[model samples]
Target: MFDNFKKNSERYRDYEVIAKFIRLAIPARWRPIGYLEHLVRSRTGGRIPKGPFAGMRYIHTAFGSAYVPKLLGIYERELNPFIEQACALNCPLIVDVGAAEGYYAIGMALRNPDARVIAFEMEQKGRAALKEMAELNNVTSRVEIRARCKRPDLAQILATSDRALILCDAEGDEETLLDPETIPMLAHTHLLVEVHEFVSAGIAERVMKRFAATHKIRRIWQEDRHRSDLPFATLGTTLLPRFYLDWSVSEWRPERMSWLWMEPRTVNAPAA
Candidate 1:
């Protein structure tokens, strides 16, 4: 009976009533369920599906595109372990660039309530949604949401930090953020940045070389191989396109870096 319930729950349409009940019972605290609902709705456009969170309406917008529950699930799963390890290391500051809806930022903050998280979202709608989600998760106190992704002022803020974790997903502007000068501002920071194929033409190699000269680089998450010629598809079909590269300052060359790759979690997998 319980197995049947579990199976049925994973079926999107079959869980509509239950999702509605959860939404009504805990409006703000239902992000996981709400995210599932959003994912199901977006994947099928309100049609029935064979996955969880079946009947909820998925908002259609740029920001909404990043809210796919399956993708978020993958991110959370892949990120949590690294975050736990980082938290254990006594890292205090975390900067999240391209923090759509605050998922990563909120999750990091929730994980380490004492840590200060500065989250950056370039889109107004995304920033607003991030604020709402942060409030929903009751992590507003720990997260600082900003409307800009790149700012000299922000770089200055980071310059004062010696121990920090920086996550950058600034779409195509990643090269701009990897400036050697900026590296000093983030000297003591560990970085997790998403490298876009197009924007990173030769930039990825350049950044890597420069970072190697000054830090220890570890690849924490890599997306499946992506082809630029592929057509855009639905969230379910398109998948998250960026790769998460982890970096730390080198011990031998405290000024040089080394890097490795971490694979991304499979999308649309069973919840843990």
Candidate 2:
């Protein structure tokens, strides 16, 4: 709840930021993005039409903008390559923090049948939705649902696996949970974390520095949704306007967002 607020004063708030606040304050199904969601559901029948998670069904992803974009298969499209790479690894274990409604958790579980996904969603609604999503996709056996992932809980989870893929978006808790000095097991784990700089400042730089010694780090910035990124061919048909198309695909971010992909420098987990 607290992590969602950007803390910028009204006197100098960016218009996009203001829009984001307004969007959050209202019911998600209200307008603009909601309108687009209605159109897409009518077209795609509530399943994700394309992208890596094609054929995946959903109840809701909790957040707005996520609905239509996920259906279109371009939600956080910048991470496509990394997501594919994770699939190739067929990572034995995947830890998803802030697993809001199981987007990546369920999707990855679906893609990598051998993998077990431990999803940690603190919110009751999110946890319930994630559980439902797992059932909906019939991956309930593979996707383990959990609550908050504290440092000790994370350590225990990481220790349970030889190699795991950590997909996280802890809002501002990255600083606390991703600490290598505390959780040395991270040295052997691959991580893709959304650095919520909108609320947690300088966290991106700090995370990079922390992992520079033990991991190969690559930073990815969020990209605007484009018509080309959409799968019109996959969807088969749509006669939407240019504005609607743009709005439907947009992530509707207040400011730019980024993700850090960290691959371990060595295969072996370092000694504690």
Candidate 3:
């Protein structure tokens, strides 16, 4: 019974009803989350403080996840090393699907100046913020912002480059977008896909099956944040109470989340 209630509560939050309520009920930058954001911004000067994308300027808000962890550079700390390594490769094409406010898109752009970054965001506000960040970072020439990423659009983009790095967090749409058979170029690309099991049941299993033949798949689980994960945790805990610090780093995910990092194993990956 407790599990059921917890699951329902998670669902309510994921559907944005709870998150929306929290934002509306509480006015901006005063207490709780808003105050937490203020604290982080003052410390980092509105830039990511200590991660792969350190010194990278961010917008006033993050579209998803709490902005505090993002400023601390530990939002998805699990993927930090992998993302850094991928950026170091400086692949000619870097595609960010379901890019919200250009976190990965703009960060990767700053990391790999030579690469062309294409960001696919459906929401108008997100798209606008992405553009603003790109300009702020002065990578507008290398960054291409686009609306909803359909399979054909992805296929066409991937076809242009022999090697590409694709970071897809399209909610549950990743199942349909990352198929190697339909999008042949995907077989040649390195894909970091967030498999949304909560949003799409059995989607994680299905995503692996689609790419197993062409790539080496590594499953990465997103674990809960610890106090140690935050660079400021050691310094700030003494100043602020524990509860306030906890609210700053919490991502508040709805369910068990995992990502499939699929890298092509062969010079010519079969599009079968």
Candidate 4:
């Protein structure tokens, strides 16, 4: 019964994804109703209310983007607790790979006033917004925004720091980039890598084995947090397309992501 219900819920969400695309394909002015909701929600900025990122400001002009759910604190329940923990620990350096719009990077910076954030974003639009967000939060001085990141980039950055945290969401590229054998600097950094089983087969297992020798590894799966339950959500907007749009694509949304959190086994041990 539960399996059937879960399947139905996914089907409904997929349907909504399709409907959102169709609705957005029509020019914004023509939408008969809820156009105001679309405009207002897609506006340029917001402040995170809770968790490690509370009070952090982010620019939101990219349209039809799904991060609205994240801003509402309804996305990624699995990571929230760890985020808060990271905040309290306040590692001296944070390496945010794929730092889209500086969410994790800037948030951690705010939580740790003494920590410096090294954010890497390859996409032009996302990089622009991330820089803007860092500046708006008055954290640009501490945020080193880079256009790209590779294993060499990470090594260079880690060489200068004592202890660091790596927050990675590099899609499937992690399989190639995160090999500890190739990048020995990883042994010094804690990690929160978003595994992409959908994009690469057997990735979760391979990645785990790679780190098992040096770190205590924990796997966290995505949790379903219904958007309607968010503190800011209202009953009337429950199924509205205005709130569903993300990144100019109302059709595309990420599938369930499995995360791997790795902590070094000892202060002196190399990252496996």
Positional deviation of residue 143's Cα in model 4 after best superposition, in angstroms: 0.6
Per-residue lDDT tens digits of candidate 3, residues 153-228?
Answer: 9989988876789999999999878887898878778888888888979999988988899999999887665445
Per-residue lDDT of candidate 1, residues 182-232 (tens digit): 546554456666566554466556666666755666654332211221222
Sorted on lDDT, highest at the top, how do the candidates line up?
A: 3, 2, 4, 1
Runs in model 4 deviating more than 4 A are: 1-17, 20-45, 62-65, 232-254, 268-272
Candidate 2 versus the native: TM-score?
0.82
Query: Which candidate leads the pack in TM-score?
Result: 3
Task: Score each candidate by Cα lDDT.
Answer: 0.51, 0.79, 0.80, 0.70
Q: What residue runs in model 3 are displaced by over 4 Å at the alpha carbon?
A: 1-26, 227-241, 268-272
- Looking at model 4, the pairs that clash are 64-245, 64-246, 64-247, 65-245, 65-246, 65-247, 66-246, 187-271
For candidate 2, write residues 1-272 as lDDT tens digits: 22322332221244345448859887756544555666677778879877788899977444423577887677898899999988887678899999988889999999999889999998888888888999999999998999999999999998888889999999889888999899988998899999988887899999999999999999998765555555443332254445445555666565678999999998654225
CA-only RMSD, every prediction: 15.7, 6.1, 4.5, 4.6
- Would you list the clashing residue pairs of candidate 3? none
Candidate 4's TM-score: 0.81
Candidate with best lDDT: 3
